[model samples]
Target: MIRHAVLAATCAMALFAGAHDGLNRWTQDAVLPPLLHETSVEVRARGGELLRAFPVEDGRWRLATRIADVDPTYIEALLAYEDKRFFQHRGVDARALIRASWQALWNGRIVSGGSTLTMQVARLLENGRTGSWSGKLRQMQLALALEQRLSKEEILTLYLTHAPFGGNLEGVRAASYAYFGKGPKRLTPAQIALLVTLPQAPEARRPDRGARVAQAARDAALERLEEAGVFHSEATSAARRTAVSSSLKPFPATAFHTTERARLEQPEQAQILLTLDAGLQNRLESLAASHLNRLEPNVTIALMVADHTSGEILASVGSAAEIDDTARKAYIDMTRATRSPGSALKPLVYAMAFDLGLAHPETLIKDAPVRFGTYTPSNFDGQFRGEIKLREALQLSLNIPVVSLLERIGPERFMQRLERAGLQPQLQGSKAGLAVGLGGVGLSLHDLVTLYASFAQHGRAVTLSQYAPQPTSGQRVTASAAAWQVGEILSSAPLENAQLNHGIAFKTGTSYGYRDNWALGYDGRYVVGVWVGRADGTPMQQAFARSTAAPLLAQVFQYVAPQIAPLAPPPPETLIVSNAQLPQPLQRFETRDALKRADASRPDIVFPPSGARLAADPELPLILKLRGGTPPYAVFANGEIKALGLHSREASLGPMTQGFFELSVVDAEGRATRASIEIR
Candidate 1:
C-alpha cells in the first residue's frame, strides 16, 4: 500500500545528514534477506490448474507467483494506486518524501507515511517494526540497496511473496486462492483493490473476520483510483458494487495421494507439472468417495485412466476420501498395492496364443474339464460350453479355455511378454505357471492398466507416467495382428451401456477367495483400470468383478469419456476368417501335451503347409495329396466330410470355391493333420 503523506521536517533533515555520513556506508554493505525461500510445493495439471498444494516449512501458505502469471489489469491498477511513479523512481521517490514532509508541516495532525512499495518490501523481508525513525531509516537504506541489486520486477515479486494476508496466508497467490477460490491470474477491480490494500493492514481488514471494514477499505481505495483516473469510471463502479467473499476456500486436494507421492519423491521441487486433467481427476475422486459407505468398512475403491498413445496418466484416484476416516484405511494407496489380478490377465494370455500362431479368434476351443499336472481350473460359473470360438470363450470368461491356451504358450513366456507390455509382475511363485492364467500372480492396478494399454497401442508398450508424459517404448508385447485380434474379440464382450455408442474392450476378474475385484478396459486411445477391495486384503466372498468393479469401470468411462472413439482397424496381418474357413491346425485348440503325444504312428500333411497360396482353376477339382496316415483315411474340407473312409494315398476335394479352404484328413486312429491352401 502507498503512504502519501507522513513525515517530520526535522527528521527528514536529520535523515538527509545521516545518509551523507554513515547511511551511505550502510547501504553499500546492506545484507539482503534470503530471497530464495521455500514456497508451497504444488502439483499442477497440464493447463496449470492446481491439483494439490502443500504448506511451506513454517506451515504457511506462500505459493510462488511470477509477474506474467498475474493479470495485467491488476498490475496496472496496483502501480497507479500504490506507486504512481513505480517504474521511474529508482527505489525512494524524493518528490513524494518532500511532499509528505510539507503536508505534516501544513496539517495539524499526522497523515500517511511516505513509504514506497520498495520500502514496504524491505520491512516485510526483515520483519522490522516501522513506527520508529531508526526502523524507517533502515527500510529506506535497504530499499535503495535492493533497487541497486535487483530489477524492478524482482522487487515487485518479493513483495508479492512476502506480503502478509490474514491467517497464515503470506503471498498474493495464497490469498487469491483462499479468498477467491482461484489463482491471481484474473481478478476483478474490487478484488485487486482489496489485495493492494491488505498488505498494509492484513488482519484488521480480513474479509472473513470483518466484512464491513474490508468492504469500506476496498471501496475507499477504488474511489481514490477513480479520482486519479487510474481506472475507467465503469470499472470503478462495478468494483464498488462487487462483494468480497466473507469466507475462505480451502486449497484444492484433487489428486491428494498423487501429489503426496510426488512431493515425497522430490522434496526440493517447488512445483511439479503432471499429465492429468484437473476436471476429470476431480470427478473420479468424487466417484471414489461416493462408494466409501456403500461397501464393507475398510473397503477402498481405486481407479486410473491413461492415454495409450502417450502413456500419460490422465487421472488417478488412489483411494476414497481419507479425511479422518480411519475405518476405510484411506491412507493406503491401493492403485499401487500388489494384489491378485485373477481373470483380468486372461486377455494377455489369449493375445500371446495368437502371437505364437496357436489360435485365431474364430477358432473353436473345447472348454472341457482339463488338468495341468495337479492344477485343474474351472469356469466362474462352474459350467462349460462344450465347444466355442475363442471370442465367445473369452467373452464368457471360461477359465479352462484360457488355461488350456496358456498351457500351450507356456506361462514363462507369458510372464516375459508381460514385461514387454510394461508390467513387471511380482509373482508369488518363483516362476510363472498355468495357475498364473487365473491371477496367481501379484500385480497392481497400474500394472494391469499398462498391460491393457498395450493392446490399445497395437502391441507396442510404454510406461505410464504421472509426473510427465513418457515416450512410446515401441516394445512389442504381442504381434500387431494378435493385439488387434484380441481387442476385436474383447470389444464384443456384452458389457455395452446405453451411454456409449462405440464399444470398449474390457475384462473383469475376481481373485481366488475374492481377495480382489478388478476390471481393465480400453477404447481407441485410453485405458481404464478399476479395483475394489479392502486395503488389508480381507476376502469379500460375495464380491465379484462383473458386478462390482466392472460397473465402476463403466461408470468411469461414462464420467470421463462416455463417447469414446471406436477401436482402430484390425492390423494388416490380422486374419479375418470363420471357424470353418480357418487353417486346419488353427481351427482346433491343440494342447501342448497333445502335440507332445504325437508320434510317427500319427498322421501328417506333407503338402500345402499353411500360408501357401495356389494359382489353380476354381472350376477344376484340386488334388489334395497326403503322405503319412492310417490305411483307411477320412478326408474333410471345411469341417464337412469331403471324402471319408477312403483307403488311398491321396484324395481330390474342393472343386467349387476359389477362396481359401481348410483341408484335413483324419486317420482311423482319429489323429488328424490340416493344411490351408488358396486358389487364385
Candidate 2:
C-alpha cells in the first residue's frame, strides 16, 4: 500500500513538473556534508585499558565507535523497530514514509518517525531540520548519496557515533558508559532498551533529568521489540519492569597526573598508550588518598613502582588525589619535584667505594666525629660508634662513615657517575662537596628510583619512562659486585615490623632539617621509592624516614607485589669474608689524611705496613713498630693479647707463629691499628 502511494505521488509530481528527468534529479540534488567528526581522546594503559578520556571540541562526549563495538542484540531490535525493510531499501523506505505521512495527516500531529537509519545519519551529518517537506526531501537525497558512498556497516557506525543521549553525551559507547557505568559491548536487556530509544528525544527522555519519562520511552521500545518478535514476550516484559537509572556515572580518570600530562603533550593522539598497570595505578591512587589523613595538614605523599629489568613504570602517585585542602599542595607532582635526598645517597657512595677497591663489606672504618675545616658530618641521631664495618655503616645509614668515603670518592665524581647513568642530580651551587652525599644535593623521586634500579639491574641503570617499552642503553653505574653487596647489606637492615620481610633490600633517609623523608627499595625485578613531606619543603619535626616514608613504601609493596621477590644474589667478584680474612689494605679504610686528623696522636702502624711477608725462623722475631699515641701499648696476636703494659714504642713479638695472623696494637687511649701479615 505504501509503495503504491509513493508511485501515485510520483505520478502527481509528473503532472506538475517533468516526468523521468525530474524524478532522477530528485534524490541526487542535495549536497553532502563532512562525514568524519572529532572524537574524544583516550589515555590507555598497557593492554588497552582506558585510564582517562577527554571530551571533544564543544565539550561533547563523542567517542569513536564501530558496528562490532555494540551489542548485536540491541542492533537487531533497533533495525526491527526503526525500519523493518532497512536492508532492502537504498536509503529511504517508501512503506514507512507513506504510513508516517498518512498517520500525521489523519491525526494532525507527528507520531512514529519515518526516517530510516541512513536518513537519520544524513540529518545528523548535515544538522538539518526534520518535520518539514523540504528538510525530508534533502535528507532523502543526502541519504541516497551516503548509501552510494559508504557501506551499510559504515552508515550504521555513523548513526552509532553521532546519536545523542543527553547533555554532552554523544555516541552509543559514551551513553552506555555515562548511564550504566560500562561499555556497550554487552548490555543488559533493560540497558539495551534504554540505549535503543534514547536517541529519539535525548533531552526529553534523559534518565538523569526525569527517570519516569526515560523509563516510559524504554518500556515503549521493549513493547515494540516484543510485537516485532525481536525479543521474547516474557523477556520484553521483564525489561519493561526494570527501572531506569536516575544518575550518570562519571568516567574513569585514573593516573590523573600522568594521563593529563600525556594528553597535553600529545593532543593530536586519539589513543595514548602508557606503561602503567591500570589496576595497580588505581589501587595506589586510592591508597595515596586514604593514607594522607595520618600526616600533617601540609604534608603530601608520593610513590613510584617500576620494573627495573624493563624500565617500565608500573604505578606512580604524584600526590593525594582526593584532598581538597589547599595547604597540602595536592596539585603538585611530587614524583618529579626536586628535594634533598638525605641519607638515601649513602648506598650509592658505598657502591662506588666497593667498585674502586677502596673498601669491602668487612673493611673497618671509624664512625667518630671528623672535621673538614669548619664543616663536620655526624650520624643522624648525633651519636656515633668509634669503629664499624662498611656493611654495618651502610645498613645503619651512618652519616660519618659515608661522608668519609665520599671524601675519598670525590663528590664531583659521584655526581658525574649519576649523570652518566641518566640521572641529573641538582647541586646547590657550582661545586660538589662531601655534604652532597648527605643532603647537600637535590633529587626528585624519579632520579632516586632510577638510580636505585641500577642496583637491582646489576649496576646498570635503565632509563625509567611512562611510555611504551623502549630499548635502553643500560649505562653501567658501578660494578655488579658492588651493587650486589650494597643490596645484600640493605636486605639485613632492621625494619619497623620485625616479621615484615618481603625480600626487598630497602633504605630510608631523612634530610638535615627533617624536611624531606624517603624510603627506596628494590627486589630482583622491581624497584620502589616513596617520599613524604610538605610540597613547600618546610620542616616537619619528627618526620623521619623510618617513621614516615618507610611505612608507606612497605605498604605499597604489600599491595602491588604480594609475593616476595628475592634480592639479587651477590655477583661473582663479591668478596664475602670476616674482617680478619680481608686483604691487608682492605682490612681497614685508613686514608693517609685520616692519620693526621683531630688526633695526630692516634695509633699508627709504621712498619710491616700490611700484607707483609716475613721470615718464620724461630730465632728471627718480628718487631712491632708504632709512631703515634702514648709509649705504653698492648699488642694482640691472633685471638690473644700477647703483650701488656709495654712502655717501649718498639716490642718484639711473633717469633714462633708460622702461619698468617691478624695483629693489632692498642694505644693507651684504647684506639687500635690493625695489620694482616703472612709468615713463610
Candidate 3:
C-alpha cells in the first residue's frame, strides 16, 4: 500500500511538471506579446520629463509602455504589505499557500489570498477576474509562466503599471497625481502606505470617497511594514496617524494646446516629447487667465515665447482658456489665426530699407499725411509729427514715413523678402500694395514672432520649432548690420505709461478698428509675442497694442527674465550717426518727384510689353510698369478705369482671365499707352 501511494505521488508530480511546461509555452506564444506592447499615455516637456498623462481606454491609466521604476521606499512598503517573500519565491509562496488553504478549509470559506506580487500582476493582466477556484488556479499557472519569462523587477513593473488605485486611476503615478498633485517619485510615508494598500480594494478604500476606510487600509499597510522591520514602530505609528486626503486634486493641465497638438502629430506613439517649458507655460497660462477674466466675455489672448538663438517654442498659450462658455470661439487657437498685423511689421520694412541703403537711422523723413494716389494713410492718433529722424518715425510708429519707404522698396519686393524669411502674409489680393506697410495684410502671430526672432538673431531667419531643437544655420533674411540697427532703435522705443521697462526691444501693433492688438519683443536669448482681441472679429474700444498687449508682454518677460540674458551690442557694421553727420543720400528721404528727372517723358508699359503672351499663372504678380509717368496715373482695363491715381510707376492687374485683354494706362498728362497680353 505504501509503494502504491509513493507511485501515485510521483505520477502527480510528473503531471504537474507537464502542466507547468504547457502553461509556460502558452504564455510565451499567446500572452506576453500583447501584454508587452500595452499602450501608455505620456506627454513630455522639453527635457523629456513627464508633462501629463491620460488613460488608454475605459479610464485605466496604465503607464505600461515603459518599465515603472518606483521609489525604493514605496517598493519596500508594497512588498511588506502585499507579499513578504516576493523575491524568494518564483511566483507563489508554498508555505503561505498551504497555510491559507488550511485556514480556508477550517473556516469553510476562503480566508486570505496567498498570491505573490507576480501572481497579482498575472491576475491584473488577465483583467483581475478570479471568480471561481478554477480561475484562481489559472492565475497561479500564469504567474508561474510569467516568472520564467520576466525578471522580478519586470514583474513588479507590470504590477505597478496596472495596479488599481481608485476610481479611474490605475497606476501609482496616476494615483499620486490625482490625490497629491505630484508624481510618484517622491511620496510621504503615509502616501506610500496608502498607495501600497489601494490595489486590493481600490473603490472601498478610495481616499477621496471614503477617508475613514482609506485610513484604516493605510494603517493596516503601515502595521505590516513595521512588523516586517521595513519601517520603525514610531514611524509606522506616525504614518498611521496621518489623515487621508478627502479631496482629489486636479492634474497638471499646463500647455494643454501644445500637448494636444503633439498627440495629434504622433497618434500611435505612447510617449511624445515637445519643446515646451512647464514652468513658463504655467506662469503664462495663469497670467492669461487672470487678465482675460477682467476683459469682455468675447475677448481672448494668445501668446508664444521662443528661444531667440534656437527658435524653440518655449511657451505657447493658444488661448486664454481652452474651454469657456462665455468666450466666443474659445477653442480657436489664435496664435495660428491670420489677422491684420498693423504696425508690428514696420521694423522689417525699416530693416529692409536700411539693408538696401535707402535710409539711415538719423535720416530725416516726413510723417505728414501722405497719399499713395487716392489712398491716404493717417497716423494712429490722426496727428502728424512733420519731419522726424527715421529712428524717431519708426519708434513713434509713424505711418506716412513707413508707407513712403515701402513704396521705395516696392511692395512686391518687400513682401517677397518677408516670404523668403518664412512669413506667409495674407495679402488682400494676389499682389502687394503700399498699404501692406501699415498692417493692411494678414499674418498669423506665429509668422510675426518668427519674423521678429530673425531680427533678434541678427537677420538669420530660423524657422520656429515646436517639438525639436533648431539648428543654427538658417536663411539670411536681411543684412546683419540692418538687423542690428533696427534692434538698437526699437530697444529705446517710447514705452506707454502701462508698459514695463524690461530693456527689451519690442514693437506693438493695433489692427484696423482695434480688431487685433499685438506686441512682439526680443532680448538676447528670447522672443515673446502676445495677441489680445476678440476671436469673433468684434472690435474692442480700448484694445491698443501699447496699452493692452505690451503690458502683458512685459509681464511675461518679467516672469522669465531670470532665465534670459541682456541684448548684445550692435555689430561692427552698424552705423551710428548723428543727423548732421549723415551721408548725402542718407541726410533726408527724397520725395517721389524729388528723385525724378525734369526731362522724364510720357509713361509707357515697360513690362508685359505690347503683344507679350503672359503665362496664365505667373508665380509673381502680373506687373504692369511704366518708364516715366507723372505722379498719380490712371490704370484702365478694357477701357474701364480699374485703378485711378496710382502714385507708383507700377500697377498690379491681379491674375487675369485666360482670354485676350487690353491693359491701358493714362499718364498724369492724359497720354494713353496700351498693351495687349494673352494668357495661355
Score every model by TM-score: 0.86, 0.84, 0.82
Q: Over the stretch 1-680, how does candidate 1's per-residue lDDT look in tens digits?
A: 12323433444555566646585676788888877777889889988899888998789998888888788877777777678888888677766677666666678444545668898889888889766667777787788899989999999998788789888999898999999998899988888889878876899999999989899989988987787776788998988888887998989888777888888888778889898899899889888888767776678899999988788999999887675567767778888999999999999989988888889888888888888899988888899788888888888888999999988888888888887777878887687788888888889999999999989888888689997776767888888988888888888766634254447889999998888989999988889999999888889868888878887888888887748778999877778988777766787886877665553467766556565687776677777666555758888777888887887766777564667778788898888887767767
What lDDT tens digits, residue by residue, belong to model 3 across residues 1-680?
Answer: 23323332333243355676684665555343245535556888886667777667665666652334467788888888788889898786766666655666667665555668887888878875555545556666678778887898888887777788878787787788888888887788888888988898999999989999999988887877777888898788788778887999876666766777787888888878888888888888889988977676678899999987877999998888665545567677788899999899999999999999889999999888667788787888889888899999998898888988888898899888888888988877988888898888889999999999999988988789887786655888899999988988898875553244456889999999899999998989989999999888889986678888988887888787664467778888787878766644577886575456421756767677666677787455677877775667898878877788799887788877677878888778887778777777
- State which candidate has the highest TM-score: 1
| Model 3 stretches astray by more than 4 angstroms | 1-33, 65-69, 105-112, 325-328, 494-502, 597-680
lDDT to native, each model: 0.82, 0.83, 0.79
Between candidates 2 and 3, name the one with more favorable TM-score.
Answer: 2
Model 3 lowest lDDT segment of ten = 1-10
Q: Quick one: best lDDT, which candidate? A: 2
What ranking emerges by TM-score with the best candidate at the front?
1, 2, 3
Better lDDT candidate (1, 2): 2
True-vs-predicted CA distance for residue 392, candidate 3, Å = 0.3
Better of 1 and 3 by lDDT: 1
After best superposition, candidate 1 residue 502: deviation in angstroms? 1.9
